[model samples]
Target: MNKYNDYAKKMNCLYAELPEYLTWHKDSKEWEPRKKQEVIGRIFNCHPSDGEKFYLKLLLMHIRKPTSFKDLRTIKGKYFDTFREAAQYLGLMETDSTAEMCIEEAATYLMPAALRQLFATILVYCSPKNPKQLWLKFENFLSQDFEHKKTLNQYAIKHKVLDIIAYHLDSMGKKLQDFFFVDDDIVTRTHDNLFKEIQTERDIIIPTEDLLAIKQLNEEQKVAYDQILHHVNNNIPNAFFIDGPGGTGKTFLYRALLATIYSAGHIALATATSGVAASLLPGGRTSHSRFKIPIGENNSKPCSISKQSALAQLIKSTKLIIWDEATMAKRDIIEKFDEMLRDIMSSNIIFGGKIIVFGGDFRQTLHVILKGTKDDIIDSSIVMSPLWQHLHKLKLKQNMRASLDPHFSSYLLKIGDGIEYTNDKDEIQIPPQANVPFIDDNTTLNTLIDMVFPNINDENLDFSLFVNRAILTTRNDFVHEINDVLINRFPGEETTYFSCDENTYTCTIPDQEELFHSLTPQGLPPHKLTLKLNAPIILLRNINPNEGLCNGTRLLCKGFTPNIIYAEISVGVHAKKTVFTPRITLEAPHDNFSSIPFKRKQFPIRLCYAMTINKAQDQTLDFLGVYLKKLVFSHGQLYVALSRARSIEQLKVLIRPSTPLIQSTDYTKNVVYQEILKATDTH
Candidate 1:
């Protein structure tokens, strides 16, 4: 195990996830074919455009790698002056290159309607920064074929194209106006297929389990529930916040509320700031995906929802919006939702006079900024927003987990509340009995793994057992390293898939290309993925939130196709259900992940044997393992990682017991922003 662990530390990417239909460029991670035979192999799976069938056949008969792009385009021993005449080509456009290459390839033979579908696919998957530019550039190619003998003018042709694109975007609960500017003068439609969205909400099955839970609310839970019901029952839409720590039955209260609202045939939308938390709520979805909340530096932009769009109608009809883990979201996100709601509902009140319940613990992790400081993080919290003062704060002080271990529960409170005794570095000394002994790095990790996931290599052990435990660290690097060792020891033959990598900016220096291959930016997956059947993984992108496929969702690999992997949702409400995952191009949210900005095309998943402490938020495990090789650097990170289990007895921690400049006794750093805590205190 140690040998394999050491070997994987130096990543040599030869793992094969898909059949070797493609090969990697030497000394680089770019996805391109150097040989005629490689391109021919790819063409076999996908038919070529006009004038290529005969040329392709002739070339396949005599195949070899070409010295350059010009040589590769040579067909039937004769060169096609331009790349287009060749069977496989990548035409880079100056603006929106990815979207252009995507459309140009399909434009050769696909019908105008099919091209529209391709255009929508690019919008959904590729996420072009300027959709308007792409549409304008590809307008002619997206029109009806001239062979049909239709003599429509340019204006009429463009109108037809817009209608088709609008229809396609509407089906996905979006509108072209979302990506296009308001001044673009899109042909407006009051509504389209939003009835289907409303129906899906109406069709939701209020679980009998949740129905029964309505009667089981504890005393504190009852108070919060009654306040929400009074607001909803009286048609007085108001904004309220529920302050509850982990194991305080926050999700329990959410389900009961959903059941009552859903029982009355009224729509109640359940959303959370993070996917892990969202998956726990019945009919839950991330607030960002559900609301089209913009991501990145511009946190103050309103949601991408159009006023007359289907999502607007859904929001208008929703009787209650319960946002869980509200503390983790930036103030801009919530305020932006509030602004959009007011515009849609035509009201000046907070959240557009809608019944919205924000539930979370300020003691847990707060909104994350890439390099945010103490003041930066506190300023980003919703508590800093002027709207926070108006929120009727409700408290749930009775933690459900307290019944299991009162001492552990109270200890966690002290840690979260920042009342625990700490040294000058603001680091708390953990009880020696509270931590697994740290003999050495290797021994500590091995012990933690054994404690959380025993018999990990046993083929006969149920795979479901692996889903109930995970090793968490504050850094993504640690998670990746630990997951690599654990996956190497799992009981199946391994398959690895290499992602197609390219820098966003034209690469000028050698270091930029190297960074692209190794970069695994936030929200973007890695270039090389190694996996085995039944290996546990988590979704890194929000594919289909309605189907229980969201970021941070846990799944187990079941099978693989040419470029797809089918998996079973190992946890959450959709557990045991199978879904096929397709390769999508994911762009990093920031340029800082590498020296140069880049995008990756791969399956949006990561091994879930371990995950970052932030990603593990909102998830509770019976058996938990935490490897704190590095001190947590952000507010509430230590508290979040430590509180992910019901009791200390069920948890294991592997940390260095010695510090360089100070006396250490099971001590580690704990960051708490007291200013935000003081402002958000529910008491």
Candidate 2:
């Protein structure tokens, strides 16, 4: 059995000896044992046995209570005092001079084997100089070393240590800050300070020269712009939805609106569903970051923002809130924001009587709930929200992306609208130029790769070429495979980083270890990740927004330090700039697995020669290769993959060959929920 289980069993044995302390409850008509704290405190109060005092001290150290610093210090001192007493009483620390030696002696003799090992590991890995850094390093070490042991996981270690520290602090009535230099509360405050700093430093200076460069808006765009501008200018309460397909100048219109609003010295908060989309806007932020939207949906609780908060002040003074790529967000999020605005601004009208504009194509992917059914998805979509009906719809028709190639633009529109030509079997035919015919051999894969990533061995290839070309895939497995193959082709010495994986739970139950080992969800980084010089990688976590190392930011591997990976920014506003990315712990959500309730920690970087279409959403690429090893499963997957490329020549598709080849090719299935389209059409 694991050390935790052994310790728990020992504790339970001690609990079994408390018959005299049992209270008879008249309501329940049963004898109930006293609370754990009362029991531990009572035992400690008495001139207890060495074992009893040691266990009590340990238990008290793990209990969490909110108290003052003096009390916390007293509790901490009590724990060490008990440890020293226990060691002396047991004749284990007769000559041990150091506190660490005393602790080791006391823990070895009095604590359970599992806890003994844990304490040893903590001491070996951590130091007092940088407690937080030490704790983090210790946790990483545990994850890597004890991953197979089933006694330690990231969550378990974090909670276990924090609880021990918190309990002692609580007993002394002190905060964790008194003991450890780092704590969650401190980190949260730091982030809040950073947010305020960003807000204050963020200059929304739209260059007058750039605004002058913008030509006249088309007829469709003109109508939408005029209406939005009028509403903002007159202080009219309005909620508008700008419905446009990819490359229809929604961004163009958005910029114009932002420029006009900024020029007039009015606040126009530009936000998007994604980081990439948000970056396209003038002083834009992701809606979640800007509004402090909770990670999970909770209808009962509003946003964490209070009326006195700086964010609240910003919202109050804001003239317009333009949420780009709105269709990607869940309806509940929109409703929650609405509720928060109403609560904050004290208005019953939609979005607290503010002019909020949401823009995105309904034809694109909606709210993506993992493993959710089609019905679940549609229900969660923003179009299904009650507030959607209140939205004034504005459509942008002329395709700005394909304005030079009108025929190609028409073809794209047909595909997106699901009006593309199909045979009797309902299979769409691939255009001759766009389709890379599948030759019935392994060379087909090689041919496709050569065409997509040409001059792979060229030493002097510009970094822009890497940014321009990407292979899009339906599955993460294919993405990994293609990335591996492509990275190998790149001329450089490779550096492979192996992730430390561990079961976060110390399971006493049978077969739990086996179960955890089998669980590998999507979005979790692999055990072994390889990188080479000039190879591209995508950031899985938001490292630093100021340096443009946010999630979805792409970087090309340039060099490496002993502890950090140096890379040049390959995408976003900080493109071509070199940045240092450190090895940081990242935890994939537990909910994505079988409700296992354990986070998998790993480095937050992934190879990016190819990427899943879901990750590629809202990103526009110059050259895209759609390699379909399997059929596109989710809604708008095919459309999203195809629409990533700017023009026809820039895109290439390679489908798996059919045994009985015919005139019609097996194209990607287009899943458009007709009811949603109908609802939007009527609006």
Candidate 3:
């Protein structure tokens, strides 16, 4: 028992320092720590001793370095046995490891140092002798952490740590419930509440006074709406794709269908590829959140959703599934959902024979695979999915946003369809009316800002108006600059919130300021975040779906606490509702940092005067200012930026003079694969 305890402590110490050493960059031309390795070594008291060396060798064996586990056992059978024995003794591995145990072990080995430490601490406290006392002590340890306090709080509230510990305990033939008096029904209740909100029967009957205000669908929308409604009303199992560019009343049709279904007391599950789009629906959520889609891709695996789960039951009972912005998802994601549905319902029919309606404009963004070629991207799109053959096509051509200016709408459609005339270099000129001329005067930026943000000086200005107007940029640096300028212009006392930076596993990494500087990526709030009263900010994460605080929800800074931000929802159904947002630990993806893992503990709010075009995909702005300091590099970016404004009059484009000139018109590039569209067309 003493030997096992010593082994556990050694294993814990190794994992607590491994993240600082694991990542190797070939470009650096040497093995370099993500942070200062010496600092980690000193802090963790990790030295080049026998135990540390053994731990390193074991990690290499776990990652199957340079060979498969089977091959490694054959090549170094004796070493493999030693590593296996140590792991089993430390309760990190089982003698007869199941598939689930193997997966859990792999995830454990890959976890960041902070999480490893937390897991190790939990394991150390879990005891069969004084089960209840040990459980209480464990809870207290998590709530009042030595380090990584915010991260601990987040995982505790979400029960992520508890779930992991429970899985481990089960592997040892010990039940966590027997030890702790925790409500085992908490997870089930949370899922139930989520589904209840989604299926809530609203007052679908439109008020007689507001009858005239609810505009009737045009001929284009009527055709699609009627077809979809027909399939739903008759209980027919059908798949349909409603294809349209932005502002063609896609949302209007969605709401109408939802209303119709709810009025008839049927369940309609509405989801979107993004939180911003989802928040527009009555009880919308991101597809991943609703469906339990795995973050990392594995073509062979289905979604983590199980047949006996409440979500699966909800899916089975759902009458209609409406997926908005469907084109943004990978072909594999859709196929996986189809596969899971078939398995759950024990039927080979598509999506368990349910009526599934997918809506998106192929002219906009498709699945964005990092470092993938155009061919790779096109292949990953829904148009290339096998399920496309089963889907009936419904088209919407009317431009609701550009109804007053038909010419502008036509130009936008041309840009999206890649039919607009381009020069030999493939650059199309922008029309003068659509372009905001680059002035030599220094006041040009201020003039553009004033145009977009009218009544900025008014103390009693409607906050909603400001929230609806935003400056869209092509880069994060420009966003930071514009936000800084805008906040300085605002008439209020500025408050700076400094993040609690620490390497929870070791004390060394936080001491290296240069390391923190190098690892901090865009889309994440900085260590030092400054805000002013009435400052417009956007939520960086989906904190609470029920309260309308979701990713991309805009808010005005009303007040602040040491660890919480008091803000009023600026957009969505929860608009004007005040909410408190707490600081949380956000980790950068392994791919984001050359495969190095790190977490940033900060407030999940960023200034919203300007945001990247990629971040503005599902947002609809009343007035949009596009600052083209750099040309859009990705597909659908130009289209997304231009289509955000409700009307041409509400849009303004500022192009840097350094950009290549093309006649008197403004030139933008559009990418379209006609072959994919043809493949999706039944005709």
Worst ten in a row by lDDT for model 1: 11-20
Per candidate, the number of residue pairs that clash is: 3, 12, 6
Which residue pairs show backbone clashes in model 1? 15-496, 16-496, 17-496
lDDT of each: 0.75, 0.65, 0.65
Ranking by lDDT: 1, 3, 2
Error of 3 at 54 (Å): 33
Number of the top candidate by lDDT?
A: 1
Cα lDDT tens digits for candidate 2, 1-683: 11234334334433323333444479997655555535422233322245645434433332223133233224323433544443333222222223233233333222232232333322322223444544444443323334456697766655555544332232222335554546666434433442342344245668665476345677888888889888888999999999988889898888888888777777778888877777667677778767877765453465787788656787888889999999889888899999989988999999999999899987777777867998898888887888988999888888876657788778777776777887666666666788887765356677778888898878787755777578998888788788888888888776665443344556543323223434545766665567888788888764444345456778888764323466677765557766544334345465745544444333468888898888888888878898877777766777788889888888888887444554334464555676667778764
Q: Pick the candidate with the highest TM-score.
A: 1
In candidate 2, stretches whose alpha carbon ends up further than 4 angstroms from where it belongs are 1-202, 205-209, 297-300, 509-520, 545-547, 591-598, 657-666
lDDT of 3 by residue, 428-491 (tens): 7666765777664246667667888876767677755687889998888888878887887777
